[model samples]
Target chain A: MSFSLKKDKQGVVVVGVDGQLIVGNRQELKQKVLDTLESGGRKFVIDFTKTGYIDSSGLGVLVSLSKKIREQGGDLRLCGLNEDLQTLFELTKLDTLFAIARTPEEALAAF
Target chain B: MTQPQPPQPPQPLHVRRRATGGDTELSLDVPSDLDYVGRAVELIADQLPGGPLSPRRIRFNFRTAFAEALANAIAYGNHRDPGRVVHVRVEVAHDAVRVHVTDEGNGFDPKGVPDPTLPERLEREDGRGLFVLKSLMDQVAFNEKGNSVCLTLRAG
Candidate 1:
């Protein structure tokens, strides 16, 4: 559906991924993140508060962006991960990799 | 003589068709079904007759695999077929439990899926479904001729 990207002066991009993240919108998500990166925004706080569910494809896009951002000497962070996604991350062990914060404020300040 | 056989009642196409003929065959239907997936693992675990630790272990493996498959089939499958039902069948053979979850959507290309465990892609959610299924199940396969997928979990 409609994904919105909001940026503050801090250069920490706050992305709101709404609705479901399935196979179809996965590429859009990747492009959106890359576009944000190209625009000189590196440290990111992806808000998953509205994201009820995300499949494997969506997860892949996030990882792809994470790698892209990492190469630029910046890091991508995740915030508001739901219990289900958290469970998945815990199960997959990727939870250990990302800097997760409870809120956007916490994430932006983490770096 | 052969013409007299035509007097018999008509049979539905699905009924007239043969079973996949591997093992057990099950049929299920989903309605407004919110939670959607239920008892999928218990069904598979029941395939194991008995042992001290068999049920629990089988339950764990089958539950993980079953939840992932059903979640995809329900979450992704429903988007493609709104208000459509998902039918599941399981064949319990001596070697493994073969499960088929059929949906109303067009078939998918499984080979196009990417690997999840590659160091670079580890953070993604997209590659996890099949990877999790493959990791949990002995073998997983798709048959779209009838919009069905057959996944197998080994039995001890």
Candidate 2:
């Protein structure tokens, strides 16, 4: 799957993932994140509005992405997830691992 | 000359077929490759009847559950061997949908799968597929050989 990266005036990157976040293209997501980091991005917000489904492989990518961002002294925010996705995060207790915002504006503000 | 067996009734274009009480059924032999996974999901979605069950919810739940099961079949079951195949069957009724995913690989005990929701296992990624399937699907059953699994989902 592909993701769109939007940078606000303060340089916070809001990455919106499109289509299913499945194993077939999960690496594309990691590559995009790494690319963002290389470009001096620190504050990050991943919007899941377009992503309807995510499996364990996708979750792994997010967990690892969160850790990588934190290791670089950066913050990661997640927002706009549908209820099912929200439940997934809760079930896996991943909600405790990252800053979750209900909207992109709020996620950006969190940074 | 042996009388040609009266045109062996046109094989319903499916490898495995069955009829279940009041439910519509469809079956196909899907290639082990991941590319066909989307088609499998769509086949299940097409069987769902439009009603009070939120379309979005149905799509998400069925898609996630079906995808997880198919992924397991492809990865763990067939070992990603393109030469192998996965047999998928689906039954949809007014209130519920039933699916069976049979893979060719050596079966493993479903009970042996650890709970990914456990605190210590939160970061581990490999085991969560089954957990997600169990959580989203109404019921997840494994065959005695472990090479097959049945997932059922019902409208709320």
Best candidate according to lDDT: 2
User: Which docking class does model 2 fall in?
Assistant: acceptable
Model 1: CA > 4 A from native: B1-127, B132-147, B150-156
Residue pairs that clash (backbone atoms under 3 angstroms), model 2: none
Fnat for candidate 1 (0 to 1): 0.32
- Specify the highest-TM-score model's number: 2
**lDDT of candidate 2 at residue A14, scale 0 to 100:** 88
lDDT of 1 by residue, B38-101 (tens): 3333344444344322453354455555655666666666653546766766656656666677
User: What overall lDDT goes with each candidate model?
Assistant: 0.64, 0.81
Residue-level lDDT tens digits of model 2 in A5-65: 8899999988898877777677888899989998899989999988888877788888888
- Which lDDT tens digits does candidate 2 get at residues B1-156? 887666543222233446567666777887777666765676656655564246876678888888888888999999889799888887766787778999999999988888876878876656788888888888999999999999887766
Instruction: Tell me the native contact fraction for each prediction.
Output: 0.32, 0.49
